[model samples]
Target: MKKVLLLTCVLCLAASLAGAADTIKIGVMAPLTGAWASEGQEMKQIVDLLGEELNAKGGLLGQQVEIISEDDGGDPKTAALAAQRLSTQEVIASIGTYGSAITEASQNIYDEAGILQVATGSTAVRLSEKGLQYFFRTSPRDDDQGKVIARTIMEKGVKKVAVLHDNSTYSKGLADEAKAILEEQGIEIVFYDALTPGENDYTAILTKLKAAAPEIVLATTYYPETGLLLRQKKEMGWDVQLVGGDANSNPDLIKIAGADAAAGYLMICPPVPKDLPSEEAQNFLAAFEKKYGGTPGSIWAVLAGDAFLVIAEAIKATESTDPEELADYLHTSLKDFPGLTGLLSFNEKGDRVGDVYRVYTVDDQGNFKLLQ
Candidate 1:
């Protein structure tokens, strides 16, 4: 009995020590002060909520976790600077760089330092091909999104389509990929025009498109420009069906367009929030609303939460601050770490796999539901 008591005491001590973690640093790089600011703020909020939730439960490895945030301001130069700064801060993992442009710029910094970067929303296709050993993404990139968009449009039997893009890397790439799919399905390109984003006047563009009279107008651009073009097109009485990529999926786009929004404007994006995975997602949505007093702008947590969870798990697994060791553990261990988005696994190049998305529609009543 005495031996049993001593052994039990030692076991208890080990179990207690096992749950305690030191302060593990996670870096957050996102556009907190630009057009995409809402997404960044939502991500940061949920990341904080996760910290609170985890610490309240047991804390990570006995020590509490802290996330250090950096604002990329939606610029590549600033993003690189932010990543470099975060790297210097010695954070064990990174959770953002919310756009392809930013991710493309900042990934090099993390790669060189052997730091793990889990981009939440940087969906540009080339991101996966950089051979960055420590780079991985929690979100699906544009190519996956593009295929879904094209497939949906083709299923609808819309043959005549007009393509309008911002000519930026994210917009142009997805636009071209989407167009290729449409072509394969025998859809005719009525008008393919690349517009300079943030321009005040698209009157000529709208007028030209109205004359072409295409059955569908596909926009692959950010909200500001999308909203402007949509509002102008309505004012000019161009009544073509407007479909957009994920970039135009912002709920605020309708508010920005006001009464000028077309009656049946369909925006192709990932699955809507309520349609996401299990009760964990719903709980996060509820808690986020309870704390922040608003709905999340997009499915920001789908990206951000996965990034945070992956990093925390890696830190707990390796129990080391060395980025390379953490990355190695993640590459091996992430095979079973189910994400709200999907099952997350990575190839050697650190590219994500097994993410599936659905189309969402923005109707006149502001109801965003999965496209049936």
Candidate 2:
């Protein structure tokens, strides 16, 4: 009798172990602190919200969906380390490495580990190219947004333009792409300046560009830098039309630069929160408001929500929590999934070529409203 009971106990233990391995773990990568903190934190929150939503729906594959979040601090080395550690934690997949530099730094580690990664925010064209089997983005690449910047400026009848970027890989590539497209139309790029990031002022660059008297200044950069550029330009009384790529489209751009400084700036970016038209978007927006007391206030966070939906949908489709299988499901199923961003599909190089960039202008009250 004792021997038979022991055998039964061993069998139950084995069954439980087998059941436990079916559990799913999802990792989220973001800059939870530092200059990019607010954006990253927002991303994490939405991801958690989605996970909770999934759990409420009876979890993934009969096992609870567990999410692990790691802060990359917007540093490349740190992001790489975080990815390595998350790999050790046995996370099936990871959702981000927010900036281009961070993504570039960590892509190899993930690919070598056979871990699939989808970046919520990274938009550099180089991030997905070069045969990195796992790297994917919901955000449009530099090439796509760059052309939209040029097109919007051209449509606005700007003939003479000055282009400047922070010289980061992401900014430089986008600025160059826009330059190429605008130059084709004979818009006449009066000045193309490449400055370093982290600088609190760009008075000299603004002054030189002002001298050139270009009708438009296409500043390709993230929020902090763009805010500084706009503020300094306003201080210098340079009235040339200021525009930015997708990165500067966030509403915080105005707050950072101040209402008086950031007013009248044009942004080529994703659609505003009010305009997002899908049930998934509404669910995300409602959850965000319930948790945070307001809706998504920026493009980055909105994209983050969409990224969560992307992963969640994959979990539902694959019925297996393995990253490779989930990624395959994601790539195949995302093509037709209805979401706030639009129809999602990756091209030959894993790039988002179908993203729509809404043109926005900072109004007098320091608000970025969609420019019809």
Candidate 3:
């Protein structure tokens, strides 16, 4: 009787272990509770929705898909801790992180642990230049956006411009990129400076920028600061055109600045899902609306969905969760995978291939209208 009992116990333990291994774990690192919480929360929602749909279709490799999310809090130090936690959980891949610095903090951890990482919104060019084999992004780089901004300014016949940044890695990189291109194109840069972000008032900065008397101000900062700058500028009765970078592509900008103040503001970014012409994107928008009650407020979150799609496709094609195999497939084999953003492919440097930036203007009612 004792021998039979021991044998049954061993069999049950084996079965339990097998059942536990019957799922694939994916990690999500995002700023779930900080200044960028809205973007992060939407990232989680999109990923979760996609995971559910995938499982409904029989899951990946015949196993249920599991998502392990870690909050980066939009800070570098917090992101490092999140990355460390995710690395220990045996996740085959991780997607995430809006801020460039926050993503950078977690890059080494994932790379060292042999986990594939796809950054959704960190557009700093140097993130891919580091030669980390596991690092990739679904978003375009800063240099491409800089050229677009410069071209738009030249098209507008704006000779004098003020370039401003928030001193963050991504913001400063974009500001410098656009500034260099403008100078090369013979556009006069009347003022160039970095402003402190997260402040409710930017009147001092506005006064200084107005004194410079530029026809347009290219503000390379997030939506929060951009909204304040626009409102404050309008309050000061300055009518200078404020051209924002991709970071300002959130609806909250209009709310913060108010429609009257936000009217006529221009920005350059990848088209949101509604603007994407792909049938897959349209389907995604419909499903997202039906499930979540509305479309995503920012393109960054959609990029997170793209990151998930890319990882899922790589897994499906390779049929293996080994990071090396997945990374190799993405770097070499994956090409023109239809994503919510566009036909997605990664170059040798791990940056998304193609220039998809479009110019948009805010109307009086705060709607973002594509200009060109």
Total backbone collisions for each predicted model: 7, 0, 0
lDDT of 3: 0.92
* TM-score, cand. 2: 0.91
lDDT per prediction?
0.78, 0.80, 0.92
The digit string of per-residue lDDT tens for model 3 on 1-372 reads 999999999999999778769989999999899888989999999999999999999999999999999999999999999999999987999999898989999999999999999999999988998899999999899999999988988888988999999999999999999999999989899999999988888999888998999998999999999999989888989998999889988898998999999999999999965688888888888999999899999999999999999999999999999999999999999999999988999988788998889999999889999987
Q: Residue 236 CA error for candidate 1 (Å)? A: 1.0
lDDT of 2 by residue, 195-313 (tens): 77777777887788889889888888888889988888888777777889877756677877899898889988788776777776777788789988987676676777666667777
Cα distance off (Å), candidate 1, residue 173: 0.9
Clash pairs, candidate 3, are: none
TM-score to true structure, per model: 0.89, 0.91, 0.96
Worst 10 residues of 2 by lDDT: 331-340
CA deviation > 4 Å runs, candidate 2: 1-22
Residue-level lDDT tens digits of model 1 in 183-266: 988999999988886678888888888788788888888877888887888888777777787766566677677744644777
- Winner of 1 and 3 under lDDT: 3
Model 3 scores worst on lDDT over the 10 consecutive residues at 272-281
